[model samples]
Target: MHDDGHGPGPARRQDQGAARHEHGHSHHRAHSPSHEGARAAGRLRHRLAHLLTPHSHESADRLDPALEASARGLRALWVSLAVLGATAAVQAVVVVLSGSVALLGDTVHNTADALTAVPLGIAFLLGRRAANRRFTYGYGRAEDLAGLAIVLTIGASAAFAGWTAFERLLSPRPVEHVPAVAVAALVGFAGNEWVARYRIRVGRSIGSAALVADGLHARTDGFTSLAVLAGAGGSALGWQAADPVVGLAITAAIALMLRDAAREVLRRVMDAVDPALVDRAERALSAVEGVHGVGELRLRWIGHRLRAEVAVVVDGEATVRQAHAIAVDAEHALLHAVPRLTAALVHADPAPVAGQADPHLALAHHARV
Candidate 1:
């Protein structure tokens, strides 16, 4: 027996439970206030922890959290793009005035980082499309492709920055308008830092690996912007080679960002999710009434939402109707316990009986094939 968790399955059971609880409500009325208070306190703690260190998939209670998340992701992308664009524009003017290679490298990277939002925005839009016959899983994977594009863009920017820095190192030149370079670098740092925090918060809340990777990229740019300030200080002290050296350092930072972003995107493409989520699913399934055992359980991301497939063991003597009821209960438990979970498929299996042939034995040869 199987349950898809979208239909109204076993509503009679829920109503009966409510009725029973209401009949016995007077017996537990004295403790209800404390229990409610404890639950509220727990929720507050979890909320605070989530804000302090955001994870990939946080719990949401919206009817269509996926759609809400997508809208938030798009808004974050456009706002971040505008912020970084302005930062880069200001640094570009400073680069022209001071001719600081370090500032130039930072500007280039900031511009590229800002433009990354374009492909990501497109991917978010694509993700909203309904699934078709050919693409049964929908266009969610487009975000992964956008993440690949971001990684490549980061790589290209790093290469260009490295090359420019090398050329400047070979032919040393004075960096003029040192004070202006310092001011521009500070501006870049502030802007990138704000955008990084914004993107990361929204990305984590929405469970978008690509958006988080982009946020990390912006964070690296912020630090590199600070490095530009060091070069400005050196140029003021008559160290003509300092600007190129700092530019090279910025390139190395971008390379590191590229490595990290590539790894995250690759993991998403591989359908990797946090192991703790699997553990939680197992616990939830085991807790469901009438579930004798939890068999194999699997979870994978379809865009920011999660889908689950799990097998649960029930009494072999139970009727088909009873087994199916257990499956529906298991599915409901799973959907409630797993954060970001939009759907679940629960399969009920009969437990083994002594002297009985294995029910799946007939299909063993097919499994091998």
Candidate 2:
């Protein structure tokens, strides 16, 4: 829906006095870079104010929200790639002018961050593909594989930064152009921090853990970028070891990012989701009028979005039409309850007696231990 950031949406506008379930997400047409830039600025500003608010529902929900979000995410990746690429290019020039290994390490890390946008962008683009026989769930899982690649990139960056740092430690060298190095370091910090904030903001909105982790990576790179300044400062102080020591510190910081990135990527691979999100889904299922109780509820990440399988108990005497209606309502409710829930499979089963056997329960399920 078009959100000009003025007031309530059409659904909320119907009854502005009361809180309502948001049935739709918001987006505005970006006619130009200034338009998108202003939106981003406004997003950060109004984030806290609209933290608990959901998108208002529209009369006709034509496009898939999940696909739209993926498209937006791809655009964000493209912009970040451009910003970081330019930042890295500027630093690379500085690295040639002033041979500071710490600056070099930071530059390498930023370059890798820019390169990472390629895989993730590919993943987002591929995620928009319709499901096929060979890949029934589409290529969403490619995002996870891309996340793995990101983790590998982080590790490789750490190794290179660490090695260069140690090599410099062993053979200390003079750092040239003290003022220029500091200026480049500041440029690096500004670029990375901006990209970090942008990525993290978009990632959270899109519910992409990998994107969020990558944002954190950019932030770490920002801080490491500052370390170059410390090295320049040391060199000015006639402390030759300061540059290498700072380089070592930058490596250590990257190692920390590697750990966090690995944790998030592995969790995606293992198909773990927040327990609270599952509980919200269960509550949504229970809210259905004909649903007697919520049974099995399973959720998994297909890239940034969630897919769910829910089993609901209904009155044994209900007609198939009634049951189908209940399932549809329950699915809609669950989708509204949990943000980023793209699809849900709801099974309507006859209500069982107390302590009675249900064959479905006896079968192996993803939920049971």
lDDT of 1: 0.83
Candidate 1, residue 236: Cα displacement in angstroms equals 0.9
User: What TM-score number comes out for model 2?
Assistant: 0.80
What are the lDDT scores of the predictions, listed in order?
Answer: 0.83, 0.80
Cα lDDT tens digits for candidate 1, 76-122: 99999999999999999999898888999999999999999999999
Backbone clash pairs for candidate 1 read none
For model 2, how does the per-residue alpha-carbon lDDT over 1-369 read when each residue is reduced to its tens digit? 121122346555434311121111132222356644664565475456556775543322412677777987888889999999999999999999989899999999999999999999999988877666787777889889988999999999989989998999999989999899999999999999999999999999988887888899999999998999999999999998999999999999999888988998899899999899988888878766667888878999988878788778866555454455567667767767988776666777776667856645545575656
lDDT, candidate 2, at 210: 77
Tell me how far the alpha carbon of residue 282 in candidate 2 is from the true structure, in angstroms, after superposition: 1.5
Cα error, candidate 2, residue 73 (Å): 1.3
Among all windows of ten consecutive residues in candidate 1, which has the lowest summed lDDT?
A: 20-29
TM-score of each: 0.83, 0.80
Superposed Cα deviation of residue 226, candidate 2 (Å): 0.9
Tell me, by TM-score, which candidate is best: 1
